[model samples]
Target: MSSAPIAAAPAHILELARRVLEIEAEAVRALADRLGDDFIAAVGLVLASRGRVIVSGVGKSGHIGRKFAATLASTGTPAYFVHAAEAAHGDLGMITADDVLIALSYSGSGEELLKIVPLIKRQGARLIAITGNPDSPLAREADVHLDGAIREEACPLNLAPTASTTAALALSDALAVALLDARGFGADDFARSHPGGALGRRLLTHVSDVMRSGPAVPRVAETALLADALMEMTRAGMGMTAIIGDGDGDRIIGIYTDGDLRRSLASGCNFSTARVADVMSRGPKTIHPEALAVEAAEMMERLRISQLLVADREGRLVGALNHHDLMLAKVI
Candidate 1:
């Protein structure tokens, strides 16, 4: 049976979505031009804070406050959200005298927030306000005020908190990133904070984690014929073989790759007669087994090589890896 044809959405619906995006985008852009000393002071306060940061607000601002606190906490700063309404009902006890309070209000006059501002100040905590109306009571009472004003909401009725919420969220993210930079927070630090994600796995996974060790490592002695080395590489399916020195199978003297084979054939060298020591490239690039897989990828790219012999601190070959190994680990 044929399914009934679905009705097409009205063109006005798509137009409205575009208009909303345009207004929200403009609001976020305007925030860049408005930033100055107060924004810097807010960052400084958080950086110098001896205790955690307390973010609070009411209604839509309260929702934005929760996200703001989460972003700060995730990006090297310690912060948490405290709902303005809940603060009046004894949740305020969660706030400490050594903490910094960041209050959010579009009008700078949220009754619930205003009710607790003086009380919070009495506790010896510094107050930072994010509001649209600089002249409002919240801004007037705050130690520092960061402007979150926008021209208008994207809502046609000018009532919904569309553009305002977007502006507040953007400003909060900017603050978090600025603090992240000031604290020298790096990808490794971020990965540590998110150990369950793919990025974390890529950053934390070591060369040893994905390397082929023991019999799987394609290795041949330096005195071995090129044909024997080629056979070892073929058996291992690594496309390359390590030429080890006489002392032990661990000392990597050189390496032979398919590229080297092509070049040797072009030079009219007979693989069947040549020793691996004569054809292998000396001083092959290597990496430590303890090193991150991403670092191995970097070495491969910079040296224009496809494989690396994993070595110990003494330069003894412990394992082997190639671009394919990195690809399998999703580190490429």
Candidate 2:
């Protein structure tokens, strides 16, 4: 006979889950209470270092170290990760005297780290240790030791690393945020670092970059017939046309759109004989070529309009764009 499997009740599983969360939350909260001069010193060390921060660790601590390096790098502090074992195998060349070393070890006694830390110190690089035990050799030798010690692991057996890693990650994030504030890193500065992202594109792409210009801009003389204006709008695919003063003049007298055409037809205007200037809307909303694309999107939304005329400093129609173009550019 085959033995039947046993399953824990839903209530029991839920209780276990809640207990794990509570333990982890307590571990993070305890970190704040433990902060003192050492936390401040860690922030100062990174802020004062002229070169990058070199983060090193082994096992689960190594994974947290990678996150620590990324957070610091993204938040205005230059940092990179080096595996503790790899450092012993010639990756130590990446470290320099000007750089600061941040080593992560929950037990403060990873053999690979022990082998690498001494060589790093010999190079004159300052050491900062994030460890669970302050009495460990790693903490004793570190110039500044961050106390990541927790009362116990969230694991029921207290053998697997759980609370300790969470405390270390949170503490490292605190250091990065403090250094970011000290550097006065702003949105513009972050955009420069991440120019390929959507936020960077929104901030850096100008109206002129995406606006239809030159012959693609639908334009007609103010005296042109409604039929002629409609032809230009259809050919340009912008759903609207700019009606400027006669004789190739640069001044935008008004704008005539598909909506205007509809209203004109509703009012019984003769499209064949009526002039564009006679029925077109005057004082149309306009944006400058130098403005950000995101600014143009905002203006269109606020006015409840679909298209905007791209004008120059002198108010001459230089280009044109509509909500469709903005959507295509992913700016809206």
Candidate 3:
């Protein structure tokens, strides 16, 4: 370690940080307002292409390009990042005639990127350039140029690529989201790509995946004694039991819960003699077994209930779930 005392940040450090955020935010807002037919032309090019999108850049712009590629891939667009320097060294073979190249260079001129642009064009690949200067060589060469210019950098010295990179990243995200919408990419599509993520589980996990099924489901006939229903609830460990029609494996008509038991006790109802139907909440909220588990969780939250009965299209009880079940499944 260097034997130098660490300088403390000035008292105006908070103000400087706020100013940086303000500048970046304003830069992004300006870019958003500046967008026009050029952005559309760029989107059109990508949508028309038969191959993947290749994002290329160097330095801080490279970082933005990588993130843009990832966002595009995750949102249904097939895209990936290739370092501009690497592309010049045999990596250029990755680009094909059908591919669309998205080049990021705030200054509109990076030696490494410029070196490969001609080869990319010669290979018949279309280029979409994002730059600060509309008159730059890269912008002039691009089939479509997106002006990502900003008033100034957020850096105190105004030399760093703070606001510029932020604007590029935001612009890239805007393009990715537009592509996502244009392709009619839905939550299920997103979940398919991100199956291990929490949003994936929320979108893909069905009631059947987390619900108690078959003999595990607590069920009692409408005519069954309250004691029998309590036994079923205890056996299933779900804190509630489905009140079904008289026959075995009948359609659910109501549900009896621990809350009902408390109400029954308060009302001086005879648990020994009372029938399940008498204490059950009739026409209880039920979800289809194919319904997403997150839907059930939301329903429970909105209704201030803990448990739900999962049923088939014919309204026959097929399964059951509780807040605990959703939690265990990581669907909540």
The best candidate by lDDT is 3
When summed lDDT is taken over every stretch of 10 residues in candidate 3, the lowest stretch is 6-15
lDDT of 3 at 331: 87
Q: Model 3, 244-310: lDDT tens per residue?
A: 9987457889999999999999999988998989889999999998888889999999999999999
TM-score rank, highest first?
A: 2, 3, 1
lDDT of 2 by residue, 1-332 (tens): 75897798999999989998899999999999999999899888888888899999999999999999998888799999999999898899999999999999999988998888889889999999999999999999899999999998999999898988899999999988889899999887777777888888888889998999999999999989999999998999989999898865577879998899899989999989999999999988899999999999999999988999998877789999999998888887
Candidate 1 structure quality by residue, lDDT tens digits, 189-262: 88887777788888899999999999999998888999999899899998899988977747988999999989
Per-residue error for 166 in candidate 1, Å, reads: 1.3
RMSD of each: 4.2, 2.4, 2.5
Model 3's alpha-carbon lDDT is 0.93
- List clashing residue pairs in candidate 1: none
For model 1, the local distance difference test gives: 0.92
Instruction: State model 2's lDDT.
Output: 0.91
Task: Give candidate 2 misplaced runs (Cα > 4 Å).
Answer: 1-6
What's the CA RMSD of model 3 in angstroms? 2.5
lDDT of model 3, residue 150: 96
Error at 265, model 1, angstroms: 6.4
lDDT of 3 at 175: 93
The lDDT per prediction is: 0.92, 0.91, 0.93
